[model samples]
Target: MSQPKKTFNDLKKDIIDNQICTSCGTCEAVCPVNAIELKNTIPNLIGNCIECGICYANCPSASFDADDMDQKVFGRTRKPIEKLTGIYQKAYQAKTTQEDIHSKAQDGGVVTALLTQFLNEGGDAVIVADLEEDKIWVPKPKVAKTREEVIKAAGTKYTPSPALVGVKQAVKIEKLEKIAVVGTTCQMRGLSLATDGPLKNKKIADAVALKIGLFCMETFNYDDYMQYLKDNDVDPGQVTKFEIKNGRFYAWNGEERLHRAKLANVKPLIRSTCSHCTDFTSEYSDISVGNVGSPAGHSTVIVRNEKGQKILDAAIKSGLIEAILIEDFDKEETLVHKLAEMKKSSHQ
Candidate 1:
């Protein structure tokens, strides 16, 4: 029997009012009608609620089942040693071969390199986050169809952007056949739910051909984040890049250091939903990449399945990226594992 659908009121009681909404904006993305929207960093009903249940069902914070997701994505559950990182076929320290990408990207520019390779090989569209030039650090979702579009959307935004909204546009609006999505762990969970979900044939879900997840500890609210920076005497408008590292958050423009603050000071600005997130490596992604354990100009990539492995192999063969493989997992020495443990313990 088809289950009775839960409405946005259920979502409100369960997640939004509780202040645990991740603000990944999957709700807005998957909404069958343009009834939902995010105001500030919270989902608000802008139009009539239809009680479709897709928004609630697809929310990582609302309906995410970690164990069921692991089994669905990898065909197995986490082993004893794989508790922190979900399932991985291999691990590597990787970087982009293009100087332009490496110069502007957040970590190693590997994600951009991957997108370039994907688009070059006939990917119909890609969902990426783009910043408004007039609004400094503000971010919005973009459906990119060309290599230039992918390169333009490079870099990290400490504030969350609903990049998955591009999926809806790519699949339903543009009628794209294949699309790649790059997002943080929570957003990845939402994507995996829609794509590999029991309701698997959703148009937006079926259109996702590649999923690349970034390792994220947390994201901040936009207005509060900017005010915090302003309180530090930093102009948010001039800052070109944002990064959190070694106990500090930094704002930079090219080689010029604009401002920085202790990571502890930004606590009040972090999204409340971050504390509830347990998947640090985007365990459900086909490939997960981040800046945690790699060299200054490289990314730590956890290749999670045969699809990821094959893509990495082909990208390497094409000379689009350079990678060094890690033969075995190390618990004590790796920062990624340590950080993963830290992120997981938050849920307990």
Candidate 2:
């Protein structure tokens, strides 16, 4: 029997309605016509559908084979060295050498330092999550071409920003030649699909030069996050920083702690799609960074491929960043694997 034909409506039912849409905006970005738009952080069809199936094909929530896509992009798949962490050449506990970056960065300033070095050395553009003008806490994704702009975009926003949307804007609107994309797991998965899927778009494929993925357990719903803060009598404007660590969500105003909630208390605000995602380490990205296994002021770095290694080496050699071998890579890998399993079992 022939397989059933796919369409945009199928994507709406299987993904959007199922509450598993990552909202990476690939549908809106790759649509032949202006048919898809993000409404309240969900992709909605606003125009006619040609039943071309691009939306369904590109949606990360629908799933794709990681090894197949890896082969297409890099000429081979990552070596199966570990089950949860995928393939990687090295692991390190690293931080920026620059004191100013360490002071302003979210964690260890590694990502901010790396991006600055990459751009200073002729990298074209980078997509990052930055604050939306007039909306202090909300993140709006943008392509930053300068070191200053990249630095300004530092720090993490617990809410999803769909950085691939910025990738779309960069390649099409800005006519950028090469781009580095920094995003969460799902967002990088969308990029992997775009670059190597059967219906790959060459423009999107050629435009991306590097992919940096973040370690994420889940992202929050913007409305729910704001409501949670308001219900607790906390003001968003005064929140100098937000972080998840040691089973708690912390909101700080400079040196003052404004609010502290158990991670369990905040689980209700998590985006539903995150529960179905198993990639806690961004398996498809060139490099992945997070604070899970490192000290309070350090970051865990996974160098996944040669390209990632090259950039990392240059950064270390130039004194842009410093590195130390993780005390026990296996112990940290175990921790990451446990979380990956938790997310995977949620759907079962």
Candidate 3:
């Protein structure tokens, strides 16, 4: 006998009410009908439901099987021993060649370079985190179809932006083809689930061309973090850049440090749902990029499959980016593994 199908109601009970939803917005994104909306970062059913199961089906936290999604996305399962950061063809320290982009990027500008290349190659759009015009450093999902737009969206905002919602809106609503999605680890998992889950959303699956994941230990609550900074006598306008390095978060104003907080000291401001996530290195992504193990001003890039490798190679050949073998690839992998284990043990 087969198990009963799950609907948004099940999603609400199993995920939202349980307080574990990552708020990646996959549910609202995949809903065939505009029946779902987010209320205070939690999804709620607002319209009539025909019992469609796409919401529950594509949810990252609804159920997750790393091996299953891996085979579906890459056509092969990872070896049991290659469990730390998933299967990767190579790793490198890379940076964008465009100085303006590099200067604005959170770390190395690799994501901006890759997205620019894809768009130039006729990809319709790429989903990215954009800062709201009124909210400094607040991330909102935006779909970029040009190099300038992608560059404008470069850099990291430490809050989750529900990026897959932007992907769905761009692909399903705007009728875009060949879209690339750049997201945090959980958001990447949500994209994989939409493509490969039992629901088999043909529109979403066909539209997505590339999936890039960013390294994330945890994301903070937007309001909570802003208030925390205010309480600590930090002015948002003084922050020229926000970064996490060596177990501390820093807000820099040109050559000056505006504010600094140890990672542990700011733990209380972390999003509650992040405590349920264990994917520190985006194991389900085609390629993962981060600054964790790489030196300052360079991104650690993990090439996971032929597609990812092909794109990286093309970008390098076109002079959009430069790369070199990671100086301490082993050490990089070790750091990634340590964080992954820490998140898993603490979350699970």
Candidate 4:
């Protein structure tokens, strides 16, 4: 006889209770009965259960087929030497040509530029993390359909938002035909789970058109982080931007650095779930972008597949962005590799 089917209770026991849930909202977004919802950083079951087990089956923290996902998305598994940057066709130092985006972007504005161009070219929507309720630090998932919308969502929020939920909104609620995603490493892995292997969700597989993933060290514990800021005499509302650079976290008001923290001092504030995740550069993404391994005004971009190459090339050809080989690569150690190595080793 067949074994009993697993359900949300199984997810709770295996992932939530163990504190291994990545808070990607994979269960919330893919739930057939709309039974699951994420409140802050925790997942709760609110509606009647259908016992479909999609939530249990698709949660990245619970079940991720890296080799299968790699083979399906890239036509091969990542080689042993490809541990840090994963599989990529090319790597570049890139910056956006759009002045407006450059002004608001955390670093290079390459992500905003590419998404804007894609939307202009008839892409349906982009699901991105946006600041919620005029708060500088609280990010919420958004479905952006135009250039202005995409621009507003530009910049990195150190906290984690369940961005995958926007996929559900984009595909099911809005009935969008083509969708692109801009998210962190865990979120990218969440996408990989939905589009590849035995637990594949056809809705996501058919709709998602691009993946633009950010480099991440970890997601913060919101309460702990807010307390740290309060103790430092920094009010979250006064901050104009939040930045993480060279092992330091900065709260900035335009050109003024309002407050700063050494990464180690804030280690206690990092979410416990992040300790279980090893992906630092969003290796599952078609294109990954980050501030490391590039010049001050540019982002280091990893193009992993034909689709990523096509978009990056088109962005350059359209004068929306410019690119060059990473500077001084032959002269020094690559920062991206070092961080990737650190995160993987420590997390494991």
Candidate achieving the largest lDDT? 4
Enumerate clash totals for all models, in the order shown. Answer: 0, 0, 0, 0
Candidate 1 regions with alpha-carbon error over 4 angstroms: 1-4, 330-333
Q: Residue 97 error for model 4, in Å? A: 1.1
lDDT of 2 by residue, 1-348 (tens): 976657789988899899989878877777777688886578888999988888778888885777776676557666544556767778888999988788777888888888887887788889999898898688988899887788888888999897878888998778898889888989988988887787766798898888899998899999899999999999999987899998899998877999998999999999888877878888788888988877887888988889888888999999999999765665534566677666667643
TM-score of every model?
A: 0.94, 0.94, 0.95, 0.95
Scored by CA lDDT, what does every candidate get?
0.85, 0.83, 0.85, 0.86
What lDDT tens digits, residue by residue, belong to model 4 across residues 214-327?
A: 999898888898999999899988898988887788899999999888988888988888998888889888899999888777899988899898899999999999999765
What tens-digit string does per-residue lDDT give for candidate 1 at 147-265?
Answer: 88899999998888886666767887789999999999988988888787654437876788899999988889888898888888888877878888778888997799988788888
For model 2, how many clashes? 0
> Model 3 — TM-score against the truth?
0.95
**Candidates ranked, most accurate by lDDT first:** 4, 3, 1, 2
TM-score of 4: 0.95
Worst 10 contiguous positions by lDDT, candidate 1: 325-334
